[model samples]
Target: MGKVTGFMEFERLKEASEAPESRVKHYKEFVVTLTDSEAKIQGARCMDCGIPFCNNGCPVNNIIPDFNDLVYRQDWQNALETLHSTNNFPEFTGRICPAPCEAACTLGINEDPVGIKSIEHAIIDKGWANGWVVPKPAAQKTGKKVAVVGSGPAGLAAAQQLARVGHDVTVFEKNDRIGGLLRYGIPDFKMEKTHIDRRVEQMQAEGVTFKAGVFVGEKLVEGGITNLAKESISPKELMAQFDAVVLTGGSEVPRDLPVPGRQLKGVHFAMDFLPLQNRVNAGDKLKDQILATKKNVLVIGGGDTGSDCVGTSNRHGAKQVVQIELMPQPPEHENKPLVWPYWPMKMRTSSSHEEGVERDWAVTTKEFIDDGKGNVRAAKCAKVEWVKDEATGQMKMQEVAGSEFEIPADLVLFAMGFTNPAKSILDAFGVEKDNRGNAKATTDGEGCYRTNVDKVFAAGDMRRGQSLVVWAIREGRQAAREVDQYLMGATVLPR
Candidate 1:
């Protein structure tokens, strides 16, 4: 550690964001960068623990202590290198990932954890500003060709790793843009697309090719333009063309609620609503966006996805916004002794919650009520009680009688998480899926990331179901090593 007793001397300080009222008016990032001195002080807070749990706490297993020490010593170049050693894209994770590393920080047992995310953000941003982020092309080509399906974080990570290892890597994205959720699902106010753009440029400079707007597999019959564009390619060709094919496609199939009036108008998936706004922000004109402007928006689910919906709605000038969750409200504070060094259950007030939102926990939507015109207007909901099971020692939820009520809503967005990757893409590649509908791939096992089909592998949300961006990066890097080893005799890449 740069400062051995720094943990005892300094307190945690992080980058601050603009006030909710002010930031909600614009779609640009609002976080204020920390001064050099402030960042050094924050880095000094990293204790020289014999065993750094923050590394284990991080999904990508970032070298936290090393970077903290580097920053404390004012070695900016070394700090940036340390940040990039594990994570392929720190900016994305820094902005969006729920910092489990901080949750597991050694200091978090008594006080607030080290501002690891902010430090990560600072390191990478400084690297970019200093022109330290440059492409490192392989000296020799491995003569291996890899087709990484999906250009999200997982695919991006895998593509970059393979490219660095001298494999000819190409990332295929179905969307018009490269980033999957990062470009579409996420609001620009949190992270602009320029961050992704510069990285794409660096990856390109490093010899990784990106193919966007090319939907692989069987084409949809309903859409116009029946003729296959040479521009468009088939899964059959991809199978024969590449030495290895890694499926990093995200979990696209959403978890739908099949309550009565499920087909009612003005009810849509959160993904459907969020992407359109992103398109608008990206200068692409969307004709009939699922606008929440002056609409009574009702968002269902209480996860990050739901929080994102709340933030988006508030920016859209929603008439009223209400969120519902099936689970009971968590305590304001977690019992540190029980959940230290692990993600604890507690109430989390997000930036969106602070913007404006009426939230209810332990509430279940029974049915969507509609106006005579066929547009959704209200929903019948019931509050539930949570109980614990004796045999399994598991928690269960049960609805209470006489608790049903109605709330008016002009628009209802299902912000529930995804169940699995779309079956079509998986079936196209003939990959085996687990009970959860995620691709069957073990972290440590023979044929890791290897699908039933030869030369096909899977990782990230496609393999792990819905998960954090950090986990996706970890899976992507691991899958890259597995694919590299499978292609050649062995791999020199890190796990």
Candidate 2:
């Protein structure tokens, strides 16, 4: 540890952010990275805990203490190396990851956990500013080819690893741009697109080929899932061309609310609404963009996606924004003794929620009211309570009597999370799926991440269902190693 007693001396400090009122006026990142001194102070707070539960707590198993010590000692280059060793995209995770590692910090048992995410943000940003982040092209080229489908964190990580190992890697993306969900699903204010663009340039320099607007499947299928793919390659053709294929597409099938007015003009899935704004931000003009401007927006779902909707709507100059969740509200604070060293269920207020939103819990939408012109007018909702069923030993939701209510909503967005990947894409590759509709693949033992289909492997949200970007990167790295092993009889790449 750089400072043995520093944890006891310093209080946790959060990164600075623009005020909610001012930040809402534009679609740009408002959260600023910690200054070098601030980050060093944060790193000093890392105690010499014997176990380092934060390591296992992080999905990618980042060497937290080493990086913290390096940063504390002002070894910026070494800290960046330590960070890049575990995470391919710290910028993404630093901005978006919920920091489960912080929850598992030893100091968090009583005091505030170290500001690890902020320190990571500072390290990566500094790395880029100093040109420390650059292409590490393979020393020699391997006479092998690999195909990575999807360009999100998982696919990008896999492609980078394989390319660095001297294999020819080509990433296929259905969208016109690289980055799957990261390109369109997320709002610009949360994370700017320039981060993804620079990485793409670095990857290209590292001997990785990116084929955007190219879909590898039988045919393109679009049913709310955004597809700007101009060309489609058959699965057989892709299999014949590449030595191995990695499926890292996101879980794009959003869970739907099939109320009476689901067919209304103004009611849309969050995916359909979010991507357009991102495209618009990228200077792509659309004839019919879904706008929350002057509309009373109602976002249904309590997760991160719903919070993003609230933020985007506020930026769109929405009249009013309301968010409702079916589940009961969690406690404002979790019992540390009961759920230490693990993620706990507690109330979370996102920057979007702080911007402006009428948030409610224990409420379920019964129906979407129809405007006279076939547009959505409002939503009929009801308060509900969760009760345990003794016979089934499971919790069941019960609506409260006479607790029905109505919320005015000219625009309604369903941000309930995704269920699974596009079934057609998996079926095209002849890959089997689990009961949850995710690609069926185990993460342990011999030939891990290999799908039932020969020469095909699955990882990230495609195999694990919807999860954090860190988990996606971890799976991608592991899957790439497995694929390399399958190709070369053995692999030196890290698992």
Candidate 3:
């Protein structure tokens, strides 16, 4: 807890970013940080509530009140340790997480919550500057092996936890870099890759081995499985080689639109377009890169993925940008009395939305129009409305008659989110899938985080369906505890 009367005396404050006009010119991170003193006042705003819901709100269960109190007491080092005790990668989450912890703060029920995110950012930065963050290698090796497939937050968290517990951990990634989606999907303007680089260094020093460009599933190439270098390990081989395997590979298969002209040259998946631009920004040479420069860009889907597309398009100097959503828009502000202390259903404007873009809701795509030579030129869409049944209390989406309209579109990016993890790898391992097509695993009931296969585990989007990075990190840490307990009969890793 923080100062007893601090909540009434101080107001919440957070870091500000550079102007959108300036930030759009390059891919560099533009968010400014709060000075040490400014961060202290923000931290002091935390009320000494008997029960702190912010901890539960945080997927990784970060000790929010303790850090807030430490910062208030001017003890930055203790704050950093308390922050890191639960979250393995505060730097990553501090930048990208939506900060639901703040929303759930006890003070937030009546007033603004303590600036937990900004304080977290400050503490970690201070820790790095003061050389407080260092690799803590295990005193002795456990001799057990853990093979973590994927290098995203989940895999990285699990690997770090297991490695710190003295297990031999190897992280596999298909991409050339170690941080899977973190290195590719997220734009550098949000979080600089240097944060990930240092974490990789720390993990390596802690005895965790990271092998990039190693796809961990059976795939055919020019010759055959023989031509497949050991770089590509089969699921069966992984099961045999490692004492335990954790599938942290994200739900990567994008939800597709099969309307006519979807195969047009200008139409592409958000992952395809977004990752290529990120690669180019990181000094990678590409044969032909995806560009929105001077093009009319249309982004389908109205989630964070769509927001990211808008931001990227503005950076590309798009002539015009349009973001379309299928659902009808909610109220600008939610009914707080009805949905207090919970994530409310309301419209959210992202930093990407602050950049130039036209946002529309209740819009349905009918077809993608094309030029003679297979290039997408426009899209036909219709308006929709929600109709509720009186007897059944069921709601159904209905299209407005004769409301079809055409919108210009040189490029279209599908960001409708993922339906499930890729089926091939899960199938190879004979992992059971839920009705939602995500890997089936129990949580907290019995045998939590355990896949049907023996000595195998699953977490992140692969296990729980597409979710926030915070949720993935939470699962990764929890999965590590389960794996540890299975191997050693108990574990100290926090759940």
Candidate 3 overall Cα lDDT vs. reference?
Answer: 0.88
Give the lowest summed-lDDT range of ten residues in model 2: 217-226
Identify the candidate with maximal lDDT: 2
Best by TM-score, which number?
2
Residue 98, candidate 3: alpha-carbon lDDT? 89
- Give residue 162's error in model 2 in angstroms: 0.2
Query: Each candidate: how many clashes?
Result: 1, 0, 0
Candidate 2 structure, TM-score to reference: 0.99
lDDT-best of 1 and 2: 2
Instruction: Estimate the TM-score of every prediction.
Output: 0.97, 0.99, 0.96
**Stretches of model 2 off by over 4 angstroms after superposition:** 222-225
- In order, the Cα lDDT scores of the candidates are 0.88, 0.94, 0.88
lDDT of 3 by residue, 383-456 (tens): 99988988889988889999999999999999999898878778888999999888899879657899999988
What are the clashing pairs of model 3? Answer: none
Per-residue lDDT tens digits of candidate 1, residues 92-144?
A: 99898889999999988898888888888888889899999999999999888
